[model samples]
Target: MGELRLMKGNEALAEAAIRAGVDGYFGYPITPQSEVIEYLMSEKPHERTGMVVLQAESEVASINMLYGGGGTGKKVMTSSSSPGISLMQEGLSYLAGAEIPCVVANVVRGGPGLGDIQPAQSDYFQSVKGGGHGDYRLFVIAPASVQEMSDFVPLAFDVAFKYRIPSLIVSDGLIGQMMEKVELFDPIPRLTDEEVIARYPWATNGKPKGKERRILTSLDLDPHKMERHNWALQEKYKLIEENETRFELIGCDDAEYIIVAYGSSSRIAQKSIQLARKKGIKVGLLRLITLWPFPKKPIEEFVKNGIKGFLTVEMSAGQMIEDVKLVVEGRAKVEHFGRYGGVIHSPEEVLEALEQKLIGG
Candidate 1:
């Protein structure tokens, strides 16, 4: 544990990344997330920790830089908004195929085009559902507040390395721009290059004294080899889903209305739960920490425990609500409430949605 600070989510993420001993950051400037780059620029963390920070010409170049650093078994990261993140998809998929560890933060905004700089969650599906292509997954962490933004950086790195996959801290403009009281933790120490190479010799740094040539690639020309790689990935995914599930349950032990929300929407949902409780609605919250490898079993268990219904709220066009519906499996009614195109709905609006469906219906 280090100290407390009132900071914006974007600033906290950059500061926390530095504290986490990240080896590098490579990202193009995109609103909301640009503060992350600015923080790194202003602090010059490299002077203190010899961390590398480079603002690339494009998202493409940034992700490639991340790829190069990752090839050397170094902790590297980047951030972008929705469209910019979308552009990085090809690199992300290749990284997944190669089993490279990295972190990508998507400070989401309205989508399908050069959407506004305001907050939105339209990237929900893109982030969670193999954004690039070909049977892949990013270890997704959805942070609901500035506090979680600060806390999730080291956790993201740990998970990324533990699973040897790309990890994401998925947030939106509201969380990115808002100021909050956050308690920062002491930077989680990470393995040095020598230590990492000792453990993961496959990393492509350079051939040493008697070591053989090392290659970093994802291509498998033979069908059988590709099939084996896919199977290995499947096993890794299973292990991750089984062991890496994380979420927050509020009054869900025995509640009639369970609200399923994540990221900034979750903060509003939490406030809605408080208000709903005061009004005698037994409302609870299931805040998703791990967006991918979705926390299904616990949610399913709650439905099995006689929870009547759930309100899936987000800033997207009911993207994740579909997953909630699938997991709920008709045992409990699942309804969705959202505002797309960067328009943020207030807590009252969410509570009203809950009132119509959960309270009155």
Candidate 2:
């Protein structure tokens, strides 16, 4: 631990990027996440760590910049809210197809189209289930607290590089705006160009001595070649599913009901668990940390252990519940409770839903 300080989640993410030794950040400001770039610019990371920070003209340009930087094997990142993220989709698809490593943080606000500046999990489908074209998936991490907002950045980068894939930190506006005590970490040194070349020979850093020139693109006109590429991507996703599913179980040991939620919804579900416990109702929480790899096995195991039912609490109209239903597979009852378009469900409201749907039935 470096030092404990009270900070907003967006600020924590910015500071963590500096400490993570990121080489550059290219992003356009968006609500609930503008603080990330604002903090970076104010801190003048270039003076301290030779980091490059640019306020791109648009989200499209920012994501393309990330694609360029990441193709060179640099640890680059960007942050935006839902609408801006939508603008970056095509670039994100290109990054994925090129197999570049980079981190993206979506401090999501409500949206089908610029719905509100308030917290919402409406983008759950977009984040977890490839928002862009092609058969690809992002390693999505959902942070429920200010502390996690800071912590997941480095973790996202580490995983992104390990697999040569894009990683995403999926947060809500509430977490981004909320202030809480967070313990910062010591700074890590950024890798030099030589180091990056040595580590990732596949990087587009020009042809080295006796090495062939690297090519980075998503275009494959040949049908057979494109099919092979798709197969390879699927294999990578399978490996990630096997090795990278992360989740947190709270009070599940003796509970009869499990509430599945992630990001800000998980925090609210925690309070709901306490409320249910006071009424002698055996309730627990299953907080998903990795949304892309979709922690399915744990839910299956809980069902096997005679867990009664599952209620997915979200800020959207039950996007994640579909995954839960798929995993549960009629082994146990499943339900969804949500408030869409920036309306956050209160603890008592969640408890009421749980009681009415899972316990009462």
Candidate 3:
């Protein structure tokens, strides 16, 4: 009940970034996500809260800008769609290797290679898996609605700064372009320069006059040192899996089957749950809020309850199904149904797939 207003997903996310005390944003324009920077530009947060919003020359420049700003302990962020995000892979790898904390949001569009501007979940593998070179993982959060589009900006920044790793809000074009009633959160004050330097001792905040020089880089000449660093990164990922994983279960207590999905797909599956229940199917929905950790624990728990099967619905060509199958490990029937390259399935279609794929039709 803080402040109620109706807003598009992209606009709300921009306002949320300002209220979240973001230090700066660096991004280039792209379809389905251009609204993000447009909103920021219209607002002129530089005058409002002293937040710097800049449109970089390209996506590659934007990501490198993130690395530079984040290295100094600033809460920097960026937004892009599929192809724009693809240009950022190398920069993302550099940020991870340096342990710089920042947030990147991908309002996904259909693509293996510049496929379409329409909403699609085809970036599932890139978001969750290591899209760039080397051993690393992004803390991936999937927001299902416009409300989440507003709510998760600060949440992503908090998690990013907490773990000192890159965090991504992996939303789709549907959520980015949709409009809905949302209650906005109260604004938080931006951290002072002194506060930032003090809070992150590792940050290269001008070396603090008399303090020891701090250098932030991803390069290591020694093989043994690099090996140790890689091991440390894995241990950090394990800690995130243990601590920051999130998901939601609905009507699951008495369900005979479950529909596993995330982002916009989860929103569709929720209604499909109602349709399945209307027909006395006794099905439930498992909405994954965190994509990287995969929520294996809940799926494994449902398996123990003797659930008949799990149907994973996505807007991709069976990418996430691999994880679902790996988790199920043949203990139950797991199958996938999807409409890729910019096609969105209806609730009836999802229910039909559920009945066919998991209900043994």
TM-score for every candidate vs. truth? 0.97, 0.99, 0.99
lDDT of 3 by residue, 63-150 (tens): 9999999999999999999999999999999999999999999999998898898899999999988789988899999999999999
Window of ten residues with lowest summed lDDT in model 2? 205-214
Whole-model lDDT values for every prediction:
0.89, 0.93, 0.92
Per-residue CA lDDT of model 2 for 1-361, tens digit only, reads 5699999999999999999999999989989899999999999999999999999999999999999999999999999999999998999899999899999999989878978899999998898888899889999999998899889989999999998899999998999999999999888899988899899988998887787778999998999999999899899999999999999999999999999999999999999999899999999999999999999989999999989999999999889999999999999999999987989999999999998988887
**In lDDT terms, which candidate is top?**
2
Query: Over the stretch 1-361, how does candidate 1's per-residue lDDT look in tens digits?
Result: 5698999999999999988989999989989788999999999987878888998999999999989999899999999999999999999999999999999999998877998888999998898898798988889999988988988998998889888999988999999999999998886555687887797777887788886898777899998989999999999999999999899987876588888999888888888888888898888899899998799987788877888888999998799988898888788888899987989988889999999976677
The parts of candidate 1 lying over 4 Å away from their true place are 188-191, 209-212
For candidate 3, the TM-score is: 0.99
Q: RMSD of candidate 2 to the true fold? A: 0.8
